[model samples]
Structure formats: structure tokens, C-alpha cells
Target: MGPVANVHADTLLIVGDSLSAAHGIEREAGWVALLRERVGDAHEVVNASISGDTTSGGAARLPDLLERHSPDIVLLELGGNDGLRGLSPQQMKLNLRTMIEKSQAADARVLLLGIEIPPNYGAAYTDAFRGVFRQLSEEYAVPLVPFILDGVALQDDMMQEDGIHPNAAAQPTILDNVWEKLGPMLSRDTDRNE
Candidate 1:
């Protein structure tokens, strides 16, 4: 074997929940993994996603990771667990806001990944939860993807048995959705020192 490749020599930290954690799928098949594959030699992806984690959980963990990795960019994908647990949308928003602000303070560019709840949750709550991301993105002036799941969420075959997480087959589509917005950010090599 030749020398092991250091894919993430320049890291991009991913802070999120089970959906970002890849849940039932192997780590390599998750969207983050797909991103690593797509980004190739240009960047390294440091996934800090934890299964069952909420926005608050991610907020709490952000400081240490930020200090450690000092990533060039952050893929912030939280709030889904907060929605699933029926937490107040305001609290979720606050948690996400805190995370986004912290990343900015650390001089890391952020890409906020929005999430949606099932229709059964009632339109009002669903709308409020979905709206949090848009509000935060506008407030922080950060780029946002309207929905992380995109093409995978409603498709039975694209999801696992849980119907919440996407299957490996669906990762490429997810990557495409994320890349649509994130690609531009990566293309511009913003000097971290500036």
C-alpha cells in the first residue's frame, strides 16, 4: 500500500443530527461522504454529526470542534431532531442561530441545510419549523439549502425502513442538491486569514 491519502487536510466541518450522521447507512454512503468524493483533492470533510442529536446538542458541541479543526467552511444540518421531538420552533431557531453566529465569529463560512417535518405535524407547525432556516439564513446573510432531503424524503425506495433517513442510493441526489448551492462557495477560495 502506498501512503494513505489525507482527503481532509483542509477540513470542512459538518454539524448535524441523524440524517447527517447517515444513521442506518454505512458512513461512506452518506451525503457527506458523497461530498468528499465530489470535492476530491480540493478539501477534507470532517463530519461531526451524531445520531438523535438536536440543534441544541449541535450548538453545545460547536465550540470545541471549531477550535480544534478551524474549518474553512461548515455544513450546518440540525433542527430535524428538534422537530421530531416536538420541541418549540423558537428554541430550535435560537439554537441554530447560535451555531451560525459562532461559526461566523470563528471566520468559517457556513451553509445552512434546511429540514422539513411530515405533514401530519400540522401545517402551522411545519411551516414555522421550515421557516426558521430561511429566517436564520437571511438574518446571518448565509447561504441556505431549502431542504436537505430534497428528492429523497418522499421517495420510499430512496429512504431506509425508518423512512426518515435516506438510503445509500439517494446520496448522490442529496449531494447534487447540496452542491447546487455549496459548489459556488467552494469554488471561491476565500482566504481564512482575511
Candidate 2:
């Protein structure tokens, strides 16, 4: 008998804030763009990021995006705008959890991208905000990248004039950070189970 072959193109949906929205950067130069290069033709990436989007906003819009894209994987990169706006961490957690549940219900594998608050924000609130991602990752048992900006967030030269958002030059590093955890998930046979 001939060997059974398993080959199916996957789709990735990225939902996040300005970071993923390619704010002040060319769409082709953002990390998501770089990610496309890394994944190649094995997957189609649909970026649903919106500038200034919060977890609440992402939660609200997620269903529509999921319906439209019907992606195999969903990269959830929200909460940065919520932290910047000083919104309640609990509310951010709620919003993110709801979005994750909705994506899972639709049979999409999820990669939660965590973000850190600028040190200027009060330590307590920032810690709580950061903790939310960890808690949800544990709760949902999904893979998570500890910090999406890792190498770029602290580098002055890598940031934009506004002191937020990575410059085009730093996008490769961001893509690397995300791909470190996300790549294996995408390449694994289990991803096909979705």
C-alpha cells in the first residue's frame, strides 16, 4: 500500500494592538511580515491588529475575525494598550480569557504573546498586568512567549521616536522572539489536529 500523506496549509491569525498593526512601520517590514517569510508557504497569516486596540477591543472583534479567517492558529497579542491606558488588570484578564476561549471553541490553536509594562508604571499594577498572561497561559495550557518585545523593548535605537513600538530595524528580533516558541507549535503534527 502507498504511504498515507498528511499535507495541509495552515492559517495564522494575529490579533493585537499597534505593535502587530505595523504602526508607523511599513506593513512589509513588521514582525508579522517577517514571520510570513519564516513560515513560508506552509501557512497563511491574517493580521487583525488594530492600532490602540485593547484586550476589550480584541475580545469584541475576535469572533468576526475568526469567522472570516477560519485560521488554524491564533496569535493573541493584546493587553499592551490596556496597560498603557492604566485600565484594570482584572478587566484585561477577563477580556483576554474570553477571547482565548472563543478562539479555542472555534478549534484554533492559540499562542499568547505576553507584553511588559514600561517601568514607569507603578510596580504593583505592572506586575499584576504581566501576571495575567502567565495565569491565562497556565489555565488554558497553551504555549506562550514570555515577552513579545524581548530584545527590542529595552534598546533605545530599536524603538520609535515616541519611545514605544519597535523601529523597522528591530522587527527581525521581535519575529525571532515570537518564533522561538511559535515555530515548533506550527511545525508539530498536533497543530494539524485543529
Candidate 3:
């Protein structure tokens, strides 16, 4: 429900693209906002997601975000835009790795959000792009949201007109996907702290 009694809140910084930024939907109707409501006083979500952000852009900006928020959890949701732009998966992996390394170095636990582009991007390319998150997560020992838009992305009605972003109705589903993994981390950490 709301805040879990007297649990001290953890600052969560979200660095991503349109999915996390609430591109075509009202800001309050986005998943990030819903996450704030879900966690209530148990967590603080600092959304730094931009509509067209890429892995490189996120890597470059991460140092600043890490310094600014000093978040206990850093949600990494980039790479979708990079895939859409046909960027090199190697470079994308490097960028993602950099961000993960940097955030971990800053003492913030990272939660990499795995994203998959449409199959039209070709099996090889799309697969590699999707693999980067898994590789990075394993290398860094970070928790990951397997697919941030899992249930939302496939449904036509769940997506926006552009079919790229999720509709307002899908925000809750998105939150549920993230919460599956994230909630446990928060709960365990909160338990240890208390």
C-alpha cells in the first residue's frame, strides 16, 4: 500500500527515454508517478527520463545525476532510442556499462531495465541490443527489470498512437513489472536498516 509504517525512504533515480518520461501521456499518469504512489513514503523517485534519450546520452549525464541525487537505487532505462536509431550494440553496451559502473561507484544500486525493439529491426541486431542489459547486469551484479513494458507493450490499446510508448492505462502494468523486482530490493534493504 502506501508507506510501510515508519520505513525510511530510499531515493530512486530513473534515467531513461520516453517510456519512463511519460511521452504521450500526462506526467502524473506515467509509471514513474505511479511508482511514487505505490512506494509512497517508502521511496523517492527522481525521474530524469527524456523522450529521446539514448544510452550514450544517459552515460554522459549519469555522473551528474549520481552526484545530484545520490540515490540508493538507480533505474537504467536507456538503449531503446539507441536501438531505434540503429546504433552499434557494442557502443550501446559500453555506454550502458559505463553508466552502471559509474552508478555503482557512487554507491547507488543499479536496476537495469531490459528493452526490446520491434522484430523489424532484424533478429540479430534486436537480440544484441536486448542482450546488453543482461550482460551488464551480470557483470555488475545489478538487479534488472527484465522488460519494463512487458505486459503493456504487446497490447495495441496499451500503446500510444505511435505504438512506441505505452498508454496511460498501461502505467499500472509497467509499475507492476518494475515492482516485482524492485520491491524486494527495497523491502530487504528496509528490513536490514530497521
Candidate 4:
């Protein structure tokens, strides 16, 4: 993709799946919106997340989103759908890498938000899935939120009836997870406003 001349350092764009899309919850209740409130009125937060979106889909659609948002920071919260579909972690990593590269090419810093699938996927597969984000983050030299679910994942109260997506109560905690890794990565220009 060709480079775009405009990059909004105060703009935060999220390219992700259901979790970031607020699958079964209110859009205002999602972590991305909460983060906007936390970051204050200075930064523009754009949510490009879609339910059931795989990394491949994210990779494919990111170029346009990058150009449209001109984001300075891109938060990638995908791969759970890929793992659930039993897709290869190696290939998922490739897709994630492609998205990160595209974002970086557009002069936006990327933050990889990691996730893990159910144990039913088998230990080896699950472990490998987890490792993909770590490897990509280290290789790309980007900040990573190891697991966005954190303390909320398996808890019945924290999740929906499907036991996959987190409920509204878990959103604030989710925002904390993102903020931990994402806060330090915000540009110096936005840092002052935040």
C-alpha cells in the first residue's frame, strides 16, 4: 500500500473482532469507548472491529481503514476467531503481521492485543495460538496486551451465555488491560493531552 501523507497522532484506531466490536453489548459499554472517555476529549477513537472477523479479513480491510482514519496508533485485537475456527496459528501470525506492517507503513504504531481459545482446541494448538501474538509483537517491536480477557475470561459472571464474549461488567477491566500496554505507546503529542 502506498503511504498516506496525513497521520493523526491523536487518533486511535482499533481493527479487531467481536470482543472489540462489543458483540452482545452496547457500543458505549465497550472498552474502546471507555478508553476514549479515559483518554479524554483530545484523542479520536475509531472502532473498526467487527464480529466474527478473522485476521485474514482484518488484513484485507486494514489498508482502507488506515487511509480513512489516518490513525497514529492501531490496536489489533483479533485471532480468537481464527483459533476458534481451528485455523493455523502460523497463518494467523502472517495475517496479523501483514496488518501490522500495513499500519506501520501508514506511519501508525500498532499494539497487538492477544487472546487464547478454549482448551478443547488441544494444548498444543492453544499454546501455539497464544505464542503467535508474542512472537509477532517481539518481531515487530510493538506493544502487546498479552490477553485482553485476563481475570475475566473463564468466570461465569464475566462472560455471556455463550461463554466466549465478555459481558458489560468485564469491560472496564478490559479497558484497564488495553490501557496498561497502550498508554505508554501513545504519541508524545497525544500524551500531553491525555
- Local distance difference test scores for all models: 0.89, 0.91, 0.89, 0.90
lDDT of 4 at 13: 94
lDDT of 4 by residue, 1-194 (tens): 99763344378999999999998999999998899898875578999999999999999999999989899889999999999999999999999999999999999989999998899989999999999999998999998899999999999999999999999999999999998988777655655655
The positional error of residue 160 in candidate 1, measured at the CA in angstroms, is 0.9
Residues 87-177, candidate 3: write the lDDT tens digits. 9999999998888889888988889899989999899998888888888888888888878889888799899888888999999999999
Tell me each candidate's TM-score: 0.92, 0.93, 0.94, 0.92
lDDT of 4 at 75: 93
Model 3 TM = 0.94
lDDT of 1: 0.89
Instruction: Determine the C-alpha RMSD for candidate 4 after optimal superposition of all C-alphas.
Output: 4.7
Residue-wise C-alpha lDDT for candidate 2, range 1-194, written one tens digit per residue:
99664477788999988999889999999999988988787788899999999999999999999999998899999999998889999999999999999999999989999999997898899899989999999999999998999989879999999988899998999899998888898768445565
Give model 4's TM-score versus the native structure: 0.92
Ten-residue stretch with the least lDDT total in model 1: 185-194
Candidate 1 per-residue lDDT over residues 114-191, each given as its tens digit:
999999999999999999999999998999999989888989999998888899999888889889988888766634
Cα error, residue 51 of model 3, in Å, equals 0.7
